[model samples]
Target: METIHLTYPETPDVVPSVMVLGFFDGVHTGHQAVIRHAQEQAERLNVPVTVVTFDPHPKQVLSNKPDAVRYITPLSRKLKRIESLGVERCLVLTFTKELAGLSPQQFVDDYLIGAGAVHVTAGFDYSYGKFGEGTMETMPFHARGRFTTSVVNEQTEGGEKVSSTRIRKLLGAGEVDAAATLLGSPYVICGEVIHGDARGRTIGYPTANVVMDASYVMPRLGVYATRVRLRDGRTFHAMTNVGRRPTFYDTGDVSIESHLFDFSEDLYGQLIEIEWVRFIRNERAFDGLDSLIAQLKQDETTARSILS
Candidate 1:
């Protein structure tokens, strides 16, 4: 697949494309349906299936929120997933203030027409232009005889719409097993292994302190069964904890620590990925070190049962 980070005003040279348009965060099931529909259109039109997407999330750019915005799949991961879906080309637009100011007609004229889009596919609720006045219904009106449009009606899983928001909620609620159903795979957390206070080691369950993407949605603060994959392609079942160390009488900063089963190697500074499997239990402060160790042993047993 070819990736073109649109450098604004100038459109790339291209063949007539069957374009799939959306933010497509997580590329969750509904987004897949839209792209898949575009793929079908591309086959019929004998054109490449191209994706028109945006980065940094429009919400982060356009609105103020109480908390930091999070992504289900960051841009790099999103593009890879798009490529895996058999898309031939992807134009990732930077959601700058200038781009956000484009009128519905201008977006249709510049991005759609400029990209040589002969046919376009998007979700029924997709909107464009300044303040999102351009909607799927209005998209054809903006096409102005230049292209055809296809609006994929809501795609559902278990009778509910499959969406990035739904996935985020699932992860936030620690419902990873259900989230995977909508995502078609386990959610991954990529990070660097960093040094900790070596608290787990002293308790005989040394863990890798993973510094993950702060902009990505994290599962609820708890212990979960996960698989840790190393850069060297090694993978192991693991018990991961996401919480502050209250028992150690420490600060309240959240942390991600994973104890790999039967694994011991210097991992500081190593990049790794964690695939969340299932939520185990809520994190809590134990009365003493011995109690903490006892609970960790139980957690490992429970995690192994789920992971194995």
Candidate 2:
């Protein structure tokens, strides 16, 4: 897939394409449905399916609590997910105050008309333009014969709409397995294994400490059964904890530490991804190292059963 990053006032010059537009945070099942529908339309039109995504999140620039934003799939992962859906081209427009101030027509003209979009597909609720005033109902009026529009109705699971917000709620509550059902894949934490205080080694568990990006959504603070995939193309059953180590000392910074079962080689500075399988227990302080070790042993057994 070909990906391009562009700002307002600049659009690609190519054959008119079928475009799907959204922030696509998780690229969850609902998002996939929209893209698939676009692909179908693209095939019928004999045009490639293209995607238009926003960066820095519109909320990041528009929200009062911009700092509170976290993402299920960061830009890098989002691109991978989008490409996996067979989108032939991706146009990423950076969100800025100037862009946010664009009137609905200005946005449509600059992004859609300028990009040579012959057909567009998006979710029923997708909106754009200043204050997000653009909607599927309004898109046709804005297109003015320049393009046709398609709307993918809301996709539901368990009688509720599948959305990135709902997925984030599941992760926040440590319902990762539930989140995966909606996401069509496991909820993953991507980061690099970094140096730690070496405390787990002293306790004999010897965990790998992952250094994750600050903008990624985190699962609830607890021990979890996980599967670890190494950058070198290896995977292992693992267990993880996400919390401030109250038993040791509280700096208030959350730690992501995982112990890969049957692993014994050095891993400092290596990159890995952890897929949350199930929550095990809340992070709690134990009496001392002995109690911590015993609890970890139990966690390992439970994790093994789940990963098995």
lDDT, candidates in the order shown: 0.89, 0.91
Model 1 accuracy (lDDT, Cα):
0.89
In candidate 2, clashing pairs total: 0
Q: Summing lDDT over every window of 10 consecutive residues in candidate 1, give the lowest-scoring window.
A: 6-15
TM-score of each: 0.96, 0.98
List ranges where model 2 is wrong by over 4 Å.
none
Question: 152, model 2: CA deviation in Å?
Answer: 0.7
Least accurate stretch of 10 residues (summed lDDT) in model 2? 6-15
Model 1: per-residue lDDT, tens digit, 1-308?
A: 99988756757665699988899988888888888899999999998988999986877777787258888898988988889998989998888778889899998888888779899889999999999999999988899988999889998899888998899999999999899999988998899999999978877999999998547898999999999999999999999999987887567788899999999899999989999999999988889988998999999999999987
Candidate 2 to truth, TM: 0.98
Write down the TM-score for model 1: 0.96
